[model samples]
Target: MPELLEVEYFRRLAERCAGRTILHIDVPDAHALADGRSPRSLRQAVVGRRIELARRHGKLLVLETDGPALGLRFGMTGGLVVDGELAIDRLLYSPGTFGTAWVRFGIRFDEGELLFHDPRRFGRVSLDPDESRMGPDAMAVTAAELGRALATRGPAPGPALKARLLDQSAIAGIGNLLGDEILWRASLAPSRPARSLAPAELRRLHRHLVATLADLLERGGSHTGDLMAERHLGGRCPKDGSPLERSTVGGRTTWWCPRHQH
Candidate 1:
């Protein structure tokens, strides 16, 4: 899936569209429009508006125009192609090639064009999407913000640690791959209770979370994590050489080093 890091790349690519007035709007796939949105509605909202900025919140990319802001959600295999250049050369789970039929939506500007491509037809386009439902963006979330997100009520434990991390309502941008990679790097067990972390542990997790996201973003995308290759049967831990363990956490496949992540 296109997570925070991937969407950030898309946002940067979209920045090239800024200051350019939209000359035309194309909606080859009506299914790509979000609920309550259509080709005619999108055209009426942004046909002549100029792109002012490109911003990202979690995995959502927003193109602020002189009129309404256009929001994009790259579901599992979606990507952004600007002026025939792809923000990402390839995605982990997506096909290696791009086809004309995969273009779900597009916009033609005075100088160039942008395409929303998704082979799986799971991506979405909307106008002025509701951003308040998401928590603080993971890329810039502070330690204090993370603490509050992980805080549990009463003495009972909250959801599994990995589950809490994956909850966009609590901390946006973390997907299945990032969640496992961050926990593995922080030496935290994926199955730990959300409230089980002590202050020191929480701080460690915060530090690792920020560092891991930065590292992956620079290296490429979420699939470039250190723990990515070891997320399989019979894979050994890179840190301790112990056998890696795989299980389901938060309804997603999880791999962790039992020897070090405690």
Candidate 2:
């Protein structure tokens, strides 16, 4: 499934579509975007009411209707791209809408409840009123906030690092890719105990965490840096000349240079 960056990249597709007065709902309770409610909500709240712009929080992308006030989560296997801009009439709601959807991506939601396309079916979509309700996007969160979250880690650092990062409450949007990015930037072995980091090292790691992500977004690329090597039978990292190594961490394949990353 696509990670956060991919999810965000695709989410932009929703912006290109011409919402011809309305759209259908396919995703679940949280799936405003998945359900067509995101654009609907935006049209009603944003376009109708005339709001300025919107933003994304962690995995949740919110449209600033400000009038209707809504947040959307694309879930896995869900995102948009404006390939066709056609919307048919009341004949009946069908994939035709997607042709007009200004984007051409759909799972053809079947769950009477809502469709969640997680190959592992491990991904989910959610919503909240505002940042106060949904909570802040991790990228916007301050170092102090991150430190407080890390401060409560387990006596051991490795598990602690993984747990805190994986937990959405401590920090939103730090998915598997982000965790590896953090570990890689810190040059600290992912298995290293979270509590074992020296104060200076922790500070540097935290700074790198934010800076690395910023640079990736600035460059508009994957935080993976080289996320694919985790699966490459034999591959070379794009950065260093060292041979890539692959192993499992938290049951997820991880690739890195022992020399480049501690």
Q: Return the top candidate by lDDT.
A: 1
Task: Write one digit per residue (lDDT tens) for candidate 2, span 1-262.
Answer: 3445554554464443322222233333333343334534433433333222445667765544334544545444343433332211111112223322222213221111112222222333333344553334567777667666666633433354655665666677766766776677677666555566677777777788778677665555454354444537676655576676777775666666677766
> 84-147 in candidate 1: lDDT tens per residue?
9989887898776778899999999999999999998888999998899898999999999999
Q: What is the lDDT of candidate 1?
A: 0.93
Q: Which stretches of candidate 1 lie over 4 Å from their true place?
A: none
The top-ranked prediction according to TM-score is 1
Structural RMSD, model 2: 8.5
Where is the poorest 10-residue window by lDDT in model 1? 149-158
Per-model TM values vs. the true structure: 0.98, 0.62
How much does candidate 1 score in TM-score?
A: 0.98
